[model samples]
Structures are given as structure tokens and as C-alpha cells.
Target: MLINEGNTNVFIVTDAVLNKLGIPAKVTDYLDAKNISYHVYDGITPDPTFNVVEEGLRQSIAANCDAIIAIGGGSVIDAAKMIAMSQGNKCKPQQLIGILKARKPSAPLYCVPTTAGTGSEATLGAVISDDKTHQKALSIDPRMVPLAAAIDPIIMKGMPAHITADTGIDVLTHALEAWMSANASVETDYYAASAVKSVMHYLPLAYKDGGNLKAREEMGIAAHYGGIAFNKAGLGYVHAIAHQLGAYYSIPSWSC
Candidate 1:
């Protein structure tokens, strides 16, 4: 399917933890079976910085990869967005930090999120942190959304309990804020309500038993719905304050 879309040579973006855990093998193993040409960049860190995206871009360029696939959580996906946009524009990742900074389309990007958090695959914005200061900058462009996203429960089944709980709350928060936003429309309200309903019912089950595939899949959908809702209706103070807290404490934004 990717090949039909002109993704002949692919670059995979992931993080060290997921790489070490071999979680990305779910996709890589399939690629191997298909004899697809690809390269893996496992340098993405929590709250990835411009330096991280730059290195990923360098590796992708060196490999002559024509497409990009992100596998892992929000940080990895956000970094991949920068890499894809930068590679497509043939520019530095830092140059694409502001809204609508890209003059051209991003590289054809696909995602297989390993965590049910952040909903980055469904969003057009990516956050990149400063290496030293840890301050975050967002880049927004419709082109940044992935061409495809696979929310497989099998891939998310191994997430730790704490992360599951934190991220489930993240989904709920996104939905609640979007529902309450002044920009909320019928479409946003529908998505936000669906997300809230899913989170309220499935989050506890997923947290208590990560192996619950149904719960995992539902939570993933909730996250996606939350992203769609907030992408149109906008977020509120919870995210604003949480983002700053995360930066100050060097914790995951969801945890804040």
C-alpha cells in the first residue's frame, strides 16, 4: 500500500525506549516480510528538540528515504513531523517552528502510535522543545497530518500502567476543553463527546489491565477524537498550564 503511494524508500522515526523494547518490530517485521527498503532513527527523546529532529533529518536524507513512518508515542511522532516537513522543504527543522512555515507539502508520512496518548497522528500541529531551556514551540500546518495512522491494540498493549492512566486523562482533558471552547461547533462537540464517553468508560479498564485489547482500542479512538475536537475548537488553560509545568518539572505533559 505504501509503495503504491510512492513510498519506495522509507525512514522510520522512533524513540530509544520503544526501540529497546522492540515495540516497533510489529511494523518492521511486516516490512521485512515484504522486503521493503527502510532505515530506523531511534534518537527521539522525551520532548524532542530541534537537535533531535535535525539528526533524524540527516539520517533520512543520507538514506535517500522518500517517505517517513513514525512509531511510538507523541514525542516521536512530533519529531517525525518536523523531519518530514524539513526534508520535504529541504530546510532546517527550526525554520518550520511557526504556523504555516512550510512553503511546500511535507513528505508522505504514516504513523503507528504505540501509546494511546497525545493523538498526534490526528493533529496538524507538532511541538518541539528547546534542548537547553526546555521551552516548547509549536508548528502548525495541515500538511503535517499523517497520510495514514494505524491504531492497533496489539502495539499499545505493553504500555506501563502509569503511562496508561496519565494518557487516558490527557484524552479526557482534550475532549473537555474542546467541548467547553467558545469555538466549539456541532462537529467538534460530537467528537469531543464521543471522546469523553470513551475515556470515562475505557480508561480504567485499560489502566488496570493493559492487555485488554478492547479497552486499548477504544482509548486510542478516544485520543484521536479528542485531537480532532481540539484541533478545531482549541484547548484551554489546563493544557496551557500543564505544558509549562511539564517543561519546568521535566515531566511528560500528560502527567502534568
Candidate 2:
């Protein structure tokens, strides 16, 4: 099922922790077995900055990557989206903000989420840092959405309790805020309600037993649903305030 004669060099953007934990290595091993050429850039930090995006972009361009496969949490995937699309646009990540009116389409992108939150794989928005202004800016464009998402529950079994809790909360926040947003539609409401129900039913089990595949799957599905809901309905004060907190304290968005 390798597409385009397997000439697409998949650029995997991830964090050092996941790389050290061997997730990227395992994925690379599989890709190698399938004779798919790929490269891994594990330099993306938590709450990534524009500089980090630029670094990944440089590597991707040098590798002549035709596609991107992000294999970590939201930060890694967010950075990958920027890297995947930056090849077509010369502007910096910050300057590409405010609805992404300036960006052109780029290579196909895929996401493999190791964590069951953030839902960056399903969304079209990426938050990049503006170092000069000490603020975070949103890059919003349908072109930023990944062409496919691989939601593997086995990969999420390694998440610690705190990560599970925080990400679960993030999912809840996304659903509720989306449901109540002024832009909410019937389609979004259905997805939001389903996400809320799944989080309430499975988050505690996933937190208590990280290896529970059922709970992990539910959370992962809920996260994706929440992402889809919010992408259409938009988020409210919670996300806006959280963005400010991330910018003000240099904290990760999930932490807020």
C-alpha cells in the first residue's frame, strides 16, 4: 500500500523523550522493513517555538521529503504541520498566522499520535511561538490538516497518569467549549456530546490502568472527535486563556 512508488520520503517530527523511549526507532524499523525511506527529527521541544519549526523544515528540505509522518504528542505533530507546509511558503511561522491567508498547499502529511490528547492530528490549527513578541500565534488553514491520522492505542500505553489526566482534561475542555461556542452547529454538537461522554466514561479507567486498551481507544477516539468538533465550531474563552497562559509562562498548552 505504499503510495507514489514509495518515493515519498516521510519526515517524522517528534520529541526527544519519545525518541529516547524508542517509539520513533520502532516506527523507523517498520518503515525500513517496508522499504520506505524516512528521517526522524526529534529536536521538537514541548510548546515548540518558531525556531524549532525552522530547524525541522530545514531537515525536511535537505532530506527532500515529499510527505510528513508525525509520531508523538501534540507539540511534535504541530511542529510537523508547520514543517510540512513551510516548504511552499517562505514566511516565518509567526508571520503565517491569522487564518493562514498567505500559505500555499504543500506535501501530504500523516500523524501518529502517541498521546491521546491535543488532537493536533485532526485539526487544522497549529500554535507557533513569536519569539520577538514573546507570544503564541495560531496558524489556521485547511491545508494544515494531516491527510491521515494513525491512532494506535498501543502507543499510548506508556503515558504516565499525569499525562493521561491532563490530556483527558484537555479533551473535555475542547468538547465543552466547542459545544457552547457561538459557532456551534448540529454536526459539531453531536461530536462534542459524544466526546464528553467518552471522556467521562473512560478517562478514569485509562488513568488508573494505562494498559487498558479499551479505555485508551475510547480516549483516543474522543480526542479526535473533540478536535473535529472544535475545528468547525471553534473554541471559547478556555482555549483563548490557555493560549495566553502558554505564551505568558512559556508553558505547554496541555499544562494549561
Candidate 3:
């Protein structure tokens, strides 16, 4: 992902998981080579909370970042979306919940997915947690979609067996749920069916051997198709129930 600014800095919001996975260093190396000024806030937790979004917003503003680049899994990208949109809204992140009206637009945003699930890079929605109410809050706006997305297979190669299994299930859920949604159209169904077939054939292989490039490539394409399907057709009960499970159990949405 490239963030262009005329002498202004760029901000990155990411989860600690990607730091542990050593992806951030790679990104920083490239930024350094390009002489880009940047700061990384890697404190975003799993199933990000409103406070987490607020913190990232504060950091982004403090750094005088004109653009935002998010690198990591869904949580990181979700947090970035919240941060980017919250720039002009003076209200707290929790206050923005259910208030679709916007006073100002957000900064340019870019995404680099380190995992093959969630597909937050391609979607217009960001799911955040209201820690006070113990409920999940969703922010949906087309402006929240990243201006660009970088899907490099090398970034997904480090996924462990458990993450691979869970994220693969997430890919399947996106496809199936989109197919069953009330808004599904002919184009949505075609993409959803293709995603289903690809996930069914390649998820297990990718999970079994993380270094399998062909399987990883297939899985990546499946995730993109699933994203496109759901982005147009919307999702149904499976996602609703899964969100409940994540909120109730304090687990990752990709996890059972």
C-alpha cells in the first residue's frame, strides 16, 4: 500500500499479531527506503474497542498524518477505518455509532491484508466494540473503503494452522451467507458459487501446508470473490450469529 503526502507524515494502525509475525518490519523497511515518514500504532487488540479507535485517532492526529495505511488482519484494518473516519467527527467513537450522518470526510486510506480473511480491505463496513455497553457497533459508509488494497501472497504464508483454519472458515461463511442473502443478484450468486468451490478445494490444503503457494493463491482469490459477493449482496444470519458469538465470548469473529 502506498500513501502519498507532500511532506506530511503517514500513520499505520495494526494489531500486535502482525508485529509478532514480523510483517510490520517488512513494511517499515520499504517505507524507509522510500524516505517516507511514518508511525505505527500496534496496540489494536482483537475485536477492537471504541477506546482503541480513539487512541489510534489521537496518534494519527498527533503525527500530522495526511494519509493512513493499515497492515494486518481484520481487527487492524477495522480500527484504521474508524480512525480515518473519526478525524473530522469530534464525537467519541462510541457516539458515532448508529449516526450515519457525517460532518466531514475522512483521510485517504489504504490496506494491506496480512491474512486471507475478513477482507476488510475491500468492504465498506467497520465493526467496533462498545466496551461500556458490551455490544458490537458497526459503522457503514462507502467512504470508509480503502482507496487501495495490496494483496500479496507472501504476507499470508506465515499463518499458523489454527489461524488458517479459522480464516478459511470465514471465507466460506462470507460466500455462503452472501448467496443466501435477500439482496443477492445473479452476479452475486456467480461469484459466491465460485468462491465456495475454491474455498472447498483449497482451504484444507493451505491449512495443511502453509508454504503451498498454489493453495495460498487460490485461497486469496476465493477471499476476494467472497468480499465482492458480500459487498454487493450483503450477508445474513450466519454473520449476525457469528458477531454475537464474538461479542459474547470475547473471541475473534473468525474463531468458532
Best model per TM-score: 1
Better of 1 and 3 by TM-score: 1
TM-score of candidate 2 versus the correct structure, residues matched by position: 0.95
Cα-lDDT of candidate 1: 0.92
Where does candidate 1 stray beyond 4 Å?
Answer: none
User: In model 3, which regions exceed 4 Å deviation?
Assistant: 1-7, 88-91
What global local distance difference test value does model 2 have? Answer: 0.86
In the range 84-172, model 3's lDDT, one tens digit per residue, is 88875655666556546556676778888878888788887889977877678998777778888888778888889889889989999
State the lDDT of candidate 1 residue by residue for 1-256, as single tens digits: 5868866788999998899999878778888887888999999988887888999999999999999999989999999999999999999988988889999999999999888878999999998887788788899999999999999999899999999998899999999999999999999999999999999999999999999999999999999999999999999999998888777676789988
Lowest lDDT 10-residue stretch of candidate 3: 1-10
lDDT: which candidate is best? 1
lDDT of 3 at 181: 91
The lDDT values for all models are 0.92, 0.86, 0.84
The backbone clash count of each candidate, in order, is 0, 0, 0
Q: Quick one: ranking by TM-score, best first?
A: 1, 2, 3
